[model samples]
Target: MTGTVTCEPGTPGVPGTVGTSGTPGAPGTPVVRRNRRATRPAPAGVDPRPSQHALTSRASEDRPEGWGDASASKQVSSYDAELQRDKPPHWG
Candidate 1:
C-alpha cells in the first residue's frame, strides 16, 4: 500500500507545500515588508543658485583666451634644425 507523507510546522518537506498550522501563501510566496522614510520639503528662503551656476561660470572663466583661436600658434618656429631632422614633414 502507498502511504501519503504529512509534514508539521517547522519540519522539512517538499517545496511549495506548506506544513500544517503554517500561514497560507507561506511556502509558495515570500512576504515582503518595506520600511520607507518620509521625505520632507526644503526649507523656505534658502538660495539654491550657488550649486547651479558656480561650476559652469568659473570653468568658462578659467579657460585661456588662446584656447580656440586658430591664429594662436603653439609652435615657436617652423624651421628649428633639431625638430626638422627628427620629425616628418606632415607633422611640422
Candidate 2:
C-alpha cells in the first residue's frame, strides 16, 4: 500500500508555496513578481557607459567626458565594423 502527504496554505502577507486560503488561485491574494533588473547593480569593474558596450571603442576614452545614457544617440546607422577597422584613429 502507498500513502500520500498533503500540505496546508500559508497565512496572508506571508510568502508560501501554496495559494491563499489553503487552496490554489484563491481570491483576496495577489502574486507579486520581483523586478530582478531594477534591483540588480552593475557587475563589479564593468563599465556602465553605453559606448563601453560596443564591440570596439575606437578612440573613446575609458571614462568618456559628459557621458550619459547615449544608447539612442550614439548609434550610427552608417557604421561599418570592417571599414572602420582599417581607418586611422579619429583625433579632434
Candidate 3:
C-alpha cells in the first residue's frame, strides 16, 4: 500500500515586481508524490501463518475418507501424531 499527496491548482500568488519576486505558479498538471512502503518476501526458512482450513486439511491427510466413525478424541490424537512424526522443526 502507498500514500500519495497530490497538489491541486489554486490561486497563484500576487505577481511581484519589487524586491525578491515570488515564485511562479505550479505547472498545469498536479504534482504527485507517492510514499510507498517497502515490501519483502519472507525468508525461505520462515513459514507464513496457515489458514484454519489448511490446518484441518494437513491434520487429516492420513485419515480414511469415512473418518466420521472415529471418536473426536481419537481424531485429534491421530492428527497430532501425523504432525509429530512427519514434520520437521523448521517446517513451522
Best by lDDT: 2
TM-score of candidate 3 relative to the true fold: 0.24
Assess every candidate by TM-score: 0.22, 0.21, 0.24
**Model 3: number of clashes?**
0
Report how far off residue 87 is in candidate 2 (Å).
25
Full-model lDDT, candidate 1: 0.48
lDDT of 3 by residue, 1-92 (tens): 23322232344442321222232224333333455569788788865544433443534646653565455465466777786789987987
TM-score, candidate 1, is: 0.22
How well is each residue in 1-92 modelled by candidate 2, as lDDT tens digits? 12322333454554443655745434444445444555556798976665656576444554443363345556644545555566867731
Which pairs of residues clash in candidate 3, taking residues 3 or more apart in a chain or in different chains? none
Q: RMSD to native for every prediction?
A: 13.8, 15.9, 14.4
The per-model lDDT (C-alpha) reads 0.48, 0.49, 0.47
Compare candidates 2 and 3 on TM-score and give the better one: 3
Per residue, candidate 1 scores C-alpha lDDT tens digits across 1-92 of: 12333434444544434533355234333423345558766578865455665543534435564364223545446556576589877886
Clashes of each: 0, 0, 0
Span of 10 residues, lowest total lDDT, candidate 1: 1-10
